[model samples]
Target chain A: MILTVTLNTALDLTYRVPALTPHTTHRVTDVVERPGGKGLNVARVLAALGHETVVTGFAGGPTGEVLRALLTPLPVRDALVPTAGATRRTVAVADRATGDTTQFNEPGPHICPAEWAAFLDSYETLLGQADAVALCGSLPPGIHVGAYAELIRRSRAAGVPVLLDTSGEPLRRGIAARPDLIKPNADELAQLTGAREPLRATRDARRRGAHAVAASLGADGVLAATPDGTWQATPPAPVRGNPTGAGDSAVAGLLSGLVEDLPWPQRLARAVALATATVLAPAAGEFDAGAYEELLPRVQVATA
Target chain B: MILTVTLNTALDLTYRVPALTPHTTHRVTDVVERPGGKGLNVARVLAALGHETVVTGFAGGPTGEVLRALLTPLPVRDALVPTAGATRRTVAVADRATGDTTQFNEPGPHICPAEWAAFLDSYETLLGQADAVALCGSLPPGIHVGAYAELIRRSRAAGVPVLLDTSGEPLRRGIAARPDLIKPNADELAQLTGAREPLRATRDARRRGAHAVAASLGADGVLAATPDGTWQATPPAPVRGNPTGAGDSAVAGLLSGLVEDLPWPQRLARAVALATATVLAPAAGEFDAGAYEELLPRVQVATA
Candidate 1:
């Protein structure tokens, strides 16, 4: 089983409005909601692709309940720790007239020390049963910045490969523990490597201690650096739709490739193909099996 | 006890972002959720003012649970009938740079036949114990436009005065029941009365079967028409700030005045003062006690 950790989960709300004007009341024509957090999103795509996955993280208040309830019908196993603060909500307002989307994100629940301890207990139990773990998304308040680093170290000690996906300080601090894999988008890679060149950033990330570094470069596709070699995988063409969750889709693809025992180049190819398909999917970050299967063999992978 | 009905309740979310751009991912800086729906808002303000208030409406799913949870801590009584769908969410994105707000409102939950029946039961039970009933907000899907008409007739039959606050077809259908008083903002009144002049429109509204009409005219204050005569209430100055809930606050003021047995002029003055104070208050539509006190004496009610 694969475990995905989301420290900050949210109720992702998408609203369709005629237009967004400052301080104007709007009659949102439509609304759609789903359980969201980086890890939850990854787990969702994994479950949709017929993978056995368990999601763990901190959730609280009514928003937490909304997340849990939303997850009940899905195939993924949920083992979220309850906290005192309400989970955050991210509102995406899509303007019908201009296709403009305005986003408003809420900081997720604050996890107390006791709640973190409880999570540790649950995570340890789950980690013991899991073949691999994926630490994903932003850290909630009251959490030490290096919390992901500790998780990476613990996963290594437990002999389970860990995939680290986060941005900024947490990602910077986490790489020191040397996780099996790190996935950062181009911008995040730049911030980490201070390099404008994608390939140089990939090498910098790998050199920073990760066994391998995978960078998702939007339309340009995936760039991978490993001790064995460096490679770039790009889809033949870009698919269109909501690109939301494409990275998480890539994470799911990476984890799925690892579980399948694929080579680095093959994994890179598969991840890029899956992400491309996800962009084409109606909702962001999900790919249909038929489209994914058709696109996998066509992705172009290049060795450095 | 005063009973307020919110057929479509919501979890109102406010998001503060530096600037909102279209079709791009944004990092939202702040989020806040509060119980919402015109009637629920009115009930909250009434409770804060020490009124024994009961809020009965259709609410369901996890968001509905949150709507109920938010009310649990307040002094108002909850009589939410369960439904199949989650109550809607309204998101307001405030752009700090432009000092503008863009809103995305969700269409409310769809109420099934059984849910409608449940609300009727709750409304009857609460109305039996209440001195007044206020039917507020837009009609949710699956509820007949004339639903408020039935409710208004029931309240009148019980010798209880009802204040109807709504717009469009629901207001059009509800007015036939001759609710003791109807409060429509100038625009709504114009749509209902077909008169460009608000005073003329208000007089037209009273002729359309409403026993009286209280018309809110934004900066111009309020104009009220009764069987006895028409009166105009003006504030000393325009109140500034978010006007989100000012309408509900005015409804609360009117109800308070009626319950206190104040003359119509005094009620109009109180309503105008409260509405002004509410706009200036931190949360739109909620009047701070101090602001209410400061503004009340300054509201001038003159014969029209």
Candidate 2:
């Protein structure tokens, strides 16, 4: 089973507004809530692809309860470690006319030292049963930025191929422990490597000790570099849509491919197809099965 | 004990950011949540003033649970009628640089006939033991605009004064029930009475069956028009601050004055003091005791 850990979980809410004007009041026409965090998003896509997945994270209070309740209907197992602080909420305001979005993100709950110790115990127990692990999202307050690095090292000791998907100082520190894979978007990659070019950034990320570096280049597609070689797989064409969770879908594709031992070319192809499909889907991190099938064979995988 | 009924309760969340740029992502520096509805705001203020308050209305689903959880630590008692749909959430983006605020309001849960009846039953039971009832905020989905009218009529029958605080269709319908007191901001009074002049509008509102219309004139102070006469109560000068929930605080002031058996002029004076205090206080619907004391007695009341 694939285990995903989200240290900071959120109740993601979407609001559809005709327009978003700053310093003004707006009445949202519709609203939807989702179980959200980078790891949760990855787990959701994996589950949708028929992978056995377990989601373990720190969740507490009412927002945590709602997150758990929302997950009950999904095809994912949850073993959330309870804490005292309420989970954070992320809000997205979609403008119907201009098709733009305004996002407001709340930093997740603060975790005391005792809570972190409890999470470590829970993680160690879950790692023993899981074949692979994916650690994602920002670390909450009171937890050190090197927290992901410690978890990565623990997962490695268990002989599990860990996938680390995060940004900023967490990613910088986590890369030193050399997780099996690290996924960073172009902007994040540039920040981490000081390389504006995707290929240069991916190579720099690999040198930083990540065994494999997958750089997401929004419309251009995924640029992946490993010890074996480098490859760039571009989708059939850019499909214009809300591309909020496309990167996470690509992570799911890459991780699921690794789990199945698929060839890197095939893995790149799958990742591109999934990322493109995610954009076509109306909601975040969702894709149409039919579109995914059509795009899979058309994805071009070439040496980087 | 004071009973505050919030027909459309919300999970009120505030996000603080350095600046706000539309269609872009923002990293909120701080987050705060509170149980919000007009009556809930009133209850919070009253609770801070050491009043034993009971908050009742329709609260349901996960959001409702979160709302209840947030209010648990407060001094107010919650006795919400459960329903199938989740309660709404309100998000506000406060820009630290400009100190501007952008608000997004969600449509609240839909109340079924059974739930509506349940709410009525609960409200009546609570009113039987209360000094007064404050029916505030917008009507929820599937509930009639005249819902406040029914409650006002019932409160009168129970020999309890009702403070009806709402606007638009609900306010229009509710005024016909002749609530003992109705508080309308200048804009609301304008909408209800269509008089450009504040005094004329308050008089017109009183003529339309509101026993009295406490018209909030923003920085200009509050004008109270009773069946017998009209009086304008102005604080020494405008208290400088963000006046978000000043109106709700005014309602609290009026209720507090009525409970203390203050005459109309004295009540107006207290309201101006409290409203000014609320404007000075950092929290919505709350006034610091020091501010209230300093502002009171300094307010000048002129009767016509």
Candidate 3:
């Protein structure tokens, strides 16, 4: 089973309005709620792909309860530890007129030291049953900066392959622990390595201690710098839809490929296909099965 | 005991951000949650004013549970009926840079036929112990447009005075039910009576069937048209803060005065003072006790 950890889970709310205007009142035409966090999104996509995925993280308060309830119907197993503070919420207000989205992200709950210790205990237990683990999303307040590094090291100690999908300092520190893989988007890659060129940045990130680096370049697709060879996988055509969870879908694809022992080229192809299908899907974190199948063989995987 | 009915209850969330720009992402600096709906606001103020207030309405799902949990610590009693649909949430984004607010109101939960019937049963039972009832706010989906009118007629049948505070068709139909009192802000009054003139519209509203009409004129205060006489109650000075719950505070003031058997002039004075103090208060739905007392004697109630 694949294990995914979301330290800062969220109740994602999407509000559709006729139009968005600053300092004005609007009546939302529709509201959609989903269980969200990078790891949770990865687990959801993994489950949809017929993989046995277990998600562990901190969930608390009313928002946490709602998030857990939302996750119950999904195929992903819930092993989230409880926290004292309320989970945060992210509101994406979509303006129908302009097709633009305004996002408001609330800082997630603070994790107590005892809660951190409790999570580590559960992580160790879950790692024993896992072939691969993905540590994703931001570190909630009160959690130490090196939390991801510790988790990655623990995964290595257990001989389980781990993928680190986070940004900023967590990614910076976690990479040094030599996770099996690290996925960073263009912006995250730039922030981590201060390099504008995608190939150079991905290489720089690999040098920082990641075993391999897969840098997402949005519409340009996934650029993978692996030990086997460097390759750039591009979609057949640019997909037009929400790109919110496309990267998480890519993470799921890469982890699934690793567990199945697929070659780097095949893994990048699957990652690109999944990310493209996620963008083509109507909702975030979900892939169009037909689109994924259609795009799989069409994905152009060539040496970078 | 005063009874306040919020047919479409909400979990009001206030998000403070540095600034609001359309179609951009924002990191909310602060988040504040409160039980909201006009009647709930009135109940909160009444509870603060040392009155025994009971709030009943439809509350369900996770948002409803959170609203109820928030209401637990308050002095007011909770008799809200449960529904299968989740309660709505209203997000008020406060932009600190511009000192402006952008509001997004979610369409509340749909009250099914069975749920509406159950609420009616509860309302009738509660009316027996009530001195006065306030029917406030917009009706949720699936509820009849004449829901407030039916509640007002039932309140009258139970010999309980009812105050109607709503807009559009609900207000139009509810007025014909001859509620004991109806409070309309200038825009609502203009919408109902087609008169931009405050005093004319207030009197017109009374003639349309409200026994008394207290028209809120924003910073100018309230113009009251009652059976006994016509009076204009003005605040001692322009008090400015958040005007969000000012009208609900005014409703609480009038209802409390009615139960205490205060004269028309005194009731208007209290209403105006409370409304002013509510504006002076930092948060919505609360009046500063010190400001309320200081402004009470200073409020000018003169024959119109």
Interface RMSDs of the predictions, in order, are 2.2, 0.8, 0.6
Backbone clashes, candidate 2: 0
Model 3, residue pairs in steric clash: none
Best by DockQ: 3
Which window of 10 residues has the lowest lDDT sum in candidate 2 chain B?
A: B280-289
Give a tens-digit lDDT track for model 3, residues A54-99. 9999999999999999999999999999999999999999988766
DockQ for all candidate structures vs. native = 0.64, 0.84, 0.90
Select the stronger candidate by TM-score from 1 and 3: 3
Cα lDDT of model 2 by residue, B157-192, tens digit: 999998999999999999999999999998899999
Candidate 2's docking class is: high
Weakest 10 consecutive residues of candidate 1 chain B by summed lDDT? B96-105
What lDDT score is found at residue B203 in candidate 2?
88
In model 3 chain B, which range of ten residues has the least summed lDDT? Answer: B278-287
Query: How does residue B71 of candidate 2 score in lDDT?
Result: 85
Candidate 2's error at A35, in angstroms? 0.4
Deviating ranges (above 4 Å) for candidate 1:
A48-50, A97-100, B96-99
Summarize candidate 1's per-residue lDDT along B1-304 as a digit string, tens digits: 9999989888887777778776666777777778999999899888887899998888888888888888889899898888898888877777767556776668888888887887787777777798888999988889998999999998988888999999999999899989999999988998998998988899899889999999988878889999878999998987667777878888998998898888999898888887888878876446778988988899988998
Query: What CAPRI grade goes to candidate 3?
Result: high
Question: Which structure is stronger by TM-score: 2 or 3?
Answer: 3
TM-score: which is higher, 1 or 2? 2
Cα lDDT tens digits, model 1, A1-304, are 9999999999888787887775678888878778998999899888886889999998888878888998999899989988999888887777787666767678777788999898888888998998889999999989999999999988998999999999999999999999999999999999998998999889989889999999999999999998778899999887666678889999998998888888888888888878888878866556767878899999999997
